[model samples]
Target: MAFLLFLLCLILVIFTVTTMGVPNIPSLDPVNRFLKGQTDVSKIVSSDFQEFFYDQTLDHFNYRPESYTTFQQRYYINYKWWGGASNNAPIFAYLGAESPIDDALWSIGFLPENAPRFNALLVYMEHRFYGQSNPVGSMEAPNMVDAMEKSLENPDTRGYFNSAQALADYAELLLYLKNQLQAHNSPIIVIGGSYGGMLASWFRLKYPHIALGALASSAPILYFENLTPPDGYYSVVTQDFKEASQNCYTTIKQSWDVIDQLATTPSGLAYLSQKFQTCSPLSNADELKNYLKSVYSNAAQYDAPPNYPTARICQGIDGASDATDILDRIFAGVVAYMPGMSCYVTSPEVVSPSESVSQTSIGWEWQTCSELLIPLGITSEDSMFQSLPYDANVFIDNCVRSFGVGPRPHWVTTYYGGQDIKLILSKFGSNIIFSNGLRDPYSIGGVLENISENIVAIKTTEGSHCLDILSSGEADPEWLVKQRKDEANIIDRWFAEYYRNFRLL
Candidate 1:
């Protein structure tokens, strides 16, 4: 799917940590592209950008026999607005998250909408180990067996999937392209949202020469290594509803106990199954609880736009008749959030438009187990969900069980410098715009303040998830309009600085 005319934000950004430190939460189903306001992407043929594949090194940090191997990495390049190598136009590259990057060419609206003004060239790099970039094989490959999930299951092929390798892939590809196109003077600005946003920020931090700056929208760089509160994520989820209405918040907070009591007897379970429209008979409260958790948290995570005074979820609850039971009203909220569903299947749980192409991949699960150890959980004490804070022992056990390896929980901060963020960035980091919507749960771990004159944070209260980087709709709030405009201005300034510094060189 392609062609771009400032389309609506096509993908939501999700980096959620699953329960009990386990991974395998499914991503937003491809069948539900409409979940993110995309209506008919099937017919949107490629026009502005063309897909290309590069032979990328399998392992960048090793010299083993496997290191010599290469995989074809997919990328999209849109040159319609490029000023060409002679003019040294900025190249905007969106670092792929844990996703099939096929959709991202038109999925994100930021680059296309703003490219014409700067005469910028837009490039979207698919992350290694995901989608068609899979080192071992791809879904498109004939005899797809022993490929993708099957390939990752093989320890020999799986070890190469890591942040370092993926970032190196981006750097090498961009460097090669620059040389090939003779764009030695053009500055490369990396862009990403959510986990890809983390990669964007880390890319700038690690390879300043390669990436001039980064637009890290909703990047939770400090979520690891105890940089933020353990309960910060779910607390924000709770606050979103509490701000909506006290009754709605209380009903959600009390939902667990009600679900527990109802799950005890077969009669209760039958009633529960019928009420939530569960496809199967209720066996335990776990699935139902998880369903509710996903519903509320996702609603809060993607909670944005036009649903003023209260979100649609809250409206469902608050507008319900006083005679309605709490559970019925809760179901009303679920219906509002996910309309037109025949029934709710709690096993895999329902992934919303809010749960984007991040997470849920075997590669990402392995990353979480190995290095991207995002310690996320909720507690009924403060949050609306049950107590489930990060348990090191449990997380380690899960990691060991799944990947036959344990997580380097502190490696991210130790490698990226999160312990003393403001001080570290002030002294060394520059030209990185860390943008967030306070409504986003990930924003709790984001840089919300100016770290330095050049390394800055741009945020808005009304925004949610990757709102600032998405398409600017006519219904876009003044804050969102200003955010995109402001980001463009800052990017313009960064380009100027890069050109000035290059001239000095």
Candidate 2:
């Protein structure tokens, strides 16, 4: 009884010390500063382009406009004329996604490569609630915690962060830039990849007056439930590997069973930890499975030609009898995504886990919890993994816990008209290009066919997601090079038509 009492007291002391103490304030990390209410924009600088902020309205839908807040949204521009921004020139703008605007500008291929041909001004706009554009206002104000607490505590401020509001920001920013440059006639071509791609398409659909056209690559505009194939994402992942090597796919599919068995015993779990080089022991079956599955899904998504992971993954999996050897080879192949990272840690808390390759910004998570919920599940029937059905209830429960609000389940589909998306887009004019790679899982939900002469889908063989939009090189595939050339020609025609009609109007 005495020994038991002393043990209990010791456990209590450790728990109290760890949990009840004053919360350790995070150090001066960039991400931590953003989260901890440090919104000083002076420190966030970029050498590639001049950064500016536009004072944007909080809500465009509200008729009583006096009852809202306005905040500065960060954007970047590079004006060193490519071919010289002569009188009749176009503006190449990227409708930034849930990421830093500068990063997107530097990484995308089309704008840098083709902007010079049209003497276009390069502009990149950061999305709301992301990067330096927190809509609730500056975090660097005095009494930082109180300001953050007040914003969170307020009811009106909580629900203003959504896609519709973001499009309005883009429209306002577009007019601001055009007026500032004194080039109202210049045709504006908006470019984006992934979620940004979705925005690019929707922007052309909603506000065609401001945006002349859009280049939306890997944009899964039809990914909502009752619209896309339930197994589309995972099945495409399996197909990428199966095309690489059937034996590899078979080995990968069977390995999940082995992992499940290994998770059952202490010795087995320890072995998996050592073999996979996981930072810690496996905590549960689901976490281990998810980490394992992400390895293949990421490889499929980024599998461009020449340097992509298909050849490498197959080379590792072929004729490999030992399960440990197979896993090691697979892990080694996928680590190409993370260059400096040493070991694979399943815990998301780690700086760069294997799953971090697929991780998005914190703002994206909030958006998913608030409105955007695209379900990704895996099953042996659909992909090269054990059966794991997606549970919509699990998603709702998680969102409820995370955001303290339930998902507006069908708001996106209802507002946008999901099933009627193709028909709705048909009513619009041309200047919208939907580019997708066959290997890309998202392609399954994207626009794959030509709607009209103006609106068209350009499909690439053996191409991964958004390859047309990424940074290009001499090493790029012949198909991609041809595709970029075709896209540029289309844009040139669009600009010509826009200027021709503008003169008449």
TM-score of each: 0.90, 0.83
Q: Candidate 1 regions off by >4 Å?
A: 1-46, 139-146, 308-310, 349-361
Colliding pairs, model 1: none
TM-score for candidate 1, residues paired by index: 0.90
lDDT of the candidates, in the order given: 0.74, 0.65
lDDT (Cα) of model 2: 0.65
Cα-lDDT of candidate 1: 0.74
Worst 10 residues of 2 by lDDT: 9-18
N/CA/C clash count, model 1:
0
Model 1 weakest 10-residue run by lDDT: 25-34
- lDDT per residue for candidate 1 within 422-487, as digits (tens), equals 987889889999998888777898999999989889999987777776655667778889999999
